[model samples]
Target: MKNIIKTILLSVAVLGMSSCSEDKILDLKPVNNILSPDAFTTPTLIESYMNGVYNAAAIGQYNSTGANGGRGYVWGAAYVEQGECRGEDVVNMATFYDLTYSSTFDATSANNVYYWVDGYRLINRCNLMIEGTTDAVAKGIITKAAGDDYIGQCKFLRAITHLELLTYFARPYNDTPGATHAGIPYRVVGVNTQAEIDSETVKPRNTVADCYTKILADLNDAETLITTGNSTAFASRVVGRASKWAAIAFKTRLYLQKRDWANVIVEGNKLTGAFALTADPYAPFQNTTGRNTSNSESIFSIQHAATSNPGVNAALASMLKDRALVCISPIIWRDADWKTDDKRREEGKFIYTAAGIKYTNKYTDVTNRTDAAPVIRYAEVVLNMAEAQARLSNSAPALTLLNSVRNRSLANPFPTAGNPVGQAYTAASFATDADLVKAILKERRIEFLQEGRRWTDIHRLQKDPIASVATNGVPAKVASAATPPTAAFVLGNSFAITTPVAAIPYDDFRFLWPIPQIEMNTNPGLGQNPGWN
Candidate 1:
């Protein structure tokens, strides 16, 4: 009976099989696998299981089909693409487009559903590692120290995966500080038996606050267990695993989402001298010469080798190349007024061709999908601190931090002379805290253009009801809080100009994606988010 139970628990359920784009929901293909009582007895087996957890966590939207960039789902770089596509930062060319830009996606939407399904898949893997590690220690299969390390890593993945789900599924925690908004069900235990699966499935969703509490606890525990003592040796391994600093950085992001401005500052300060910005503007992204080794800048990145990448069609190169499916928005080129010599505009970063198309070069290698997926970077922490300070009305300090990022892009450190060429912003640019805050926001848009953050940033800042680029021959530069203009200009099929596009309101129901319909179907206790039934 025990052997049968172990097999049932270890077997891959239909619910466990995740696809590239997360579109497919099929029947279970159970494997006859079981964890013997002493499966975690060897260090090598434990390491292999932990690596599997990492692999599961890194899987994002990449579907390897012929259509849709010949890919099923685009995961790593696709996150940046999907997040920015909905916002005003990037554009799609004639050949490629998706529901991300459409005003129609909701709870039944496959893209949104994928986030929930894939996230829990990651969490489940982590839970298994956590359980196996604990069991190994209890059975004297591994030392207490080794067990702690395994447990810490698994918990860190679980925490971040849960947080990512909340970012999509639940309203921002700050949206309703004291209110009871249903967040995704918090499951920490690995499902091994039918009873465990049933129990977890029917568990009611936790309140957003309660969910946050769990996320923070996991992060804090991870921080305690993950080591940073062996910096030199660990640097090579840190790209794939969570380090002590990585846990702290994740907390910084979590605080920002919760709108805990002071806590953001508090947590961000922990990385004071831990990481530095890459001296060259584009050095951090080069797959061959750059970022092959861990640096002070990258806290954690998903590792993809030359032999193993997300796929051909699912890479950023496929989506944002000159003749590629997606393109950069004209607004970024025209309205935002990017400098001519900006390193970001250099041939490899953004390409401008004779046909008047713009492509981002962040993911330059298409044939070999070895580009590391950046989860967190040192620069983001600096900006988060800058924004937090500005919000707290700490004027002088915020501007100083903001200028550091601005100076790096131009390759011209500030407090020098006149505006050096390629410089995006300067120290004397803003006068008030609000002005500094706005500049910081603008800088974030420029900095993380293809890093999959525009929509969430827009959502967090409450910058909504965004209007079209050109309305009746004039630029609707600033997002309108009032009613949007009808017949707004847009790039449509074949790059043709389409007009009268509706603006999304700040409190639009679509802003908060509906709970995945299948999840609601399976878990009767789960309730749908507002505006999607």
Candidate 2:
């Protein structure tokens, strides 16, 4: 990891070469030290440099030369595939994510290796931005407010990158008491000179609890310093960039993962009037028409453009919709809970049929592949608060919050009408708090089907004390080659699988991905996750 960060720092000269003309600040001549004092001069240059950091971290387009070589790195298709295929909600129908689907990935697998390499690469860029912006403020090149905003954005990116790495590399927070398991190294400083690189190479991993503490600290600082409105002197106020609400929304996710119910609600309440879910469930995924650009539901997303995309192989539309590499698994698609008449299930809208298999149409730009990757959404914050309320036995507010997200997509009425029509729950619907929590979990599975959120639920719920909300491990999945039923699909139809893949037990070491072999080779002091050679 340290060696990879050193390489990324050294290669900063070619950082934003593929970005637009406004973002071409880093296309300067190669130099021995690109982070010299003169690098942070004008507002345009500083903003462009920060744009390069965002391009590397959120867009994953700048540095694609290391462990994953030609394949696009994380924050794009690789990010979506890794998160979705690890669980049973999505089936891997091609070779791209087969190893991930079957939990057979080793330390040398490209997916895990590149995820670590690119994640730290992004983190190092954020560190450099932090240092550069602070220096610019001290030298009076930029105001204190401007410098703080830049630092806040860097911290937000840094926090998110570390959280993503923890989801894959470390065990669940509840797997052990106090979350004392090994966590990834929280890189807070930039690696520019040879001495800094040497010092970073030997840093040991931190505990999961420690990692979460650092993540929350960064997010809190970001919430305080980041701008609040949608407009600013620079382009940092756009939807894709971090803001006060985005930091708060992300804190809900982190607190939810840690099972801190009160904190989740506290953070969620801060976003009550700031953002709201779109009336249409499919509104947030419309990229070609620019509806997603001003989507009220999207809190923060990874921006992609026609000229600057993850390419055909790694684009979300290409893999999930056009090429049909992975499709919506029957495990969730055929469940009786997901209504047949729901807007999300309507053909050509969110779900599309190709060769009798259902693929997600959430991403529509197969040619341009410019679909924006969603990081956090208003729906997720609502659901997080809903689950937190249910856990606390506050059933009334929980059901109301759940319906706010669920009612929009429910267009048709069920055959038997009552308070709970079309799968909308009421106050008397759940007999127990566990049942309400289970319903909230199911809603999460349905609402966030292909948005790279399935694995997050599975990871956090694996060791849950409540039996209904807990998952044993990766659930049973349909065979990759198994064909859907020839008859017309119905809400309750059972799509029998001729070859059922067994589930990985919670105790299996494969439950968590191995530390990349490259990291082990470069930093021998770093320990590997058990059960991987």
Candidate 3:
């Protein structure tokens, strides 16, 4: 925490100069005196500071300064690769993500160490924004409404970062009766001075339940404070910035992870009329035309541009499309449940086939690498509600919500007299609630194929009582060096591989990532996860 804290304080002094070329929210000018009293006095200076925080959280320090600097929450970094490659749906074909793919990472692994460092760095920046905005309001530098909006954005970033850390560094919420397992430190105070850094160094990790409580508290605050009418500055920046609907949509994700079915529905209901799925599956990902902002499906996204994106090395297009470091694994690709005529499997759309190898084209900017990193989407919200309703035995509404996303990709979504049984799911389609839930989960895998969401579902459902969809641990996958079929891939064909990596059971020590070695050395109070030492 000391090293991470020091970085945060140092970054605050140069916040204005760290602006990246991004959407209007991130187009900031340099502020000569950022640390002076006049820093938060005007909208321009305040927005410049906010832009720095968003840049740090979105793009990170990817300038080759250090190993972890290349990875951030978005831009095909730790959150994207680690979240997908660690699961079974995607195959790792290169050395970049091998440790994460094979579950062989240790405390000192670059991915493990820097993910923790960058996450905490972003958290502290949010803290600084929160504290700075409160002071601004007190000193009459900004209005109460404006201050609340800034603080709301800070809280939203803080809550999401903490949750991301918990997903990797700690056990699932259901691992214990009350989620009493060790959780990551939820920092709310900004550390600027030497005294603050020293004080933050000795703080201990919170329990998983307590961490979730704090996350929800911050989100609840954000829900109330982040509104379109509060300030003119915020109303115009709704596309890229957090809004009331984004906060509600995020709550659905958190509640789904916790298995809070009723709460999931409650938060999901608020987004009913606010957003809808796009008619085409690829509409949300048309990066060249800025569809990520214009599309109705996107709730909140981290916008990227030609100049400000994680370059070829770490961009989503580079990793998943152009370089093909990670390919769509045959495991999900060969599943018969995914209809043969599904539009998502169509070449040149979401997927592309070349040299008999299949790659995801979800991020299409192979050269420019300017694809927007989707944080939350309306489809996810619909699926969240669908799963929650299925869990509570409300089958009709569940199927309706499920088809809202799944139907768009199917060749024939609705039933007709000529084709009585169309592709859309019916009430009779599932034998039981467990069956319905399983179908919804499968839809999530296909809908969010290469968007780095598979591992999150795998993580939260590891301890599910339902045996069908509950994952034991990391499932077996095609070997890293497994060869693709020599012939062109055919729909529903058995593309067998001779070598398959075995599964790691739930009880394995490697199930959870170890605390970074540097954090352990710097902060004596912090303890590592089991089997790391």
Please tell me which predicted candidate would have the highest TM-score against the true structure.
3
Q: What C-alpha lDDT do the candidate models reach, one value each?
A: 0.62, 0.75, 0.75
* All candidates: TM-score: 0.82, 0.89, 0.90
Show model 3 residue runs off by greater than 4 Å. 1-5, 9-38, 62-69, 74-77, 228-237, 288-291, 467-471, 481-483, 486-488, 497-499
Report the lDDT tens digits of candidate 1 across residue range 1-533.
Answer: 33222211111221332221223432111111225333466877777777656655554432222211222222345466657666765654442444565445766666666556556755776787798889888988888888888888878888887777676667667567562678877878776555666556667888989988999999999988866332633345466687777788888888877778899899888878767777766766775434423565777776666644445555555556534666555556443445545667666454534344556777666666667777778788889999889889897778878867766776444434564443435546667667777777777878777777776676555522221211211111222111122212222323323223345665667666677666676654577777776
List of clashing residue pairs for candidate 3 = none
- Candidate 1 scores a C-alpha RMSD against the true structure in Å of 6.6
lDDT of model 3, residue 478: 75
Q: Rank the candidates by TM-score, best first.
A: 3, 2, 1
How displaced is residue 272 in candidate 2, in Å?
0.8
Worst 10 residues of 3 by lDDT: 21-30
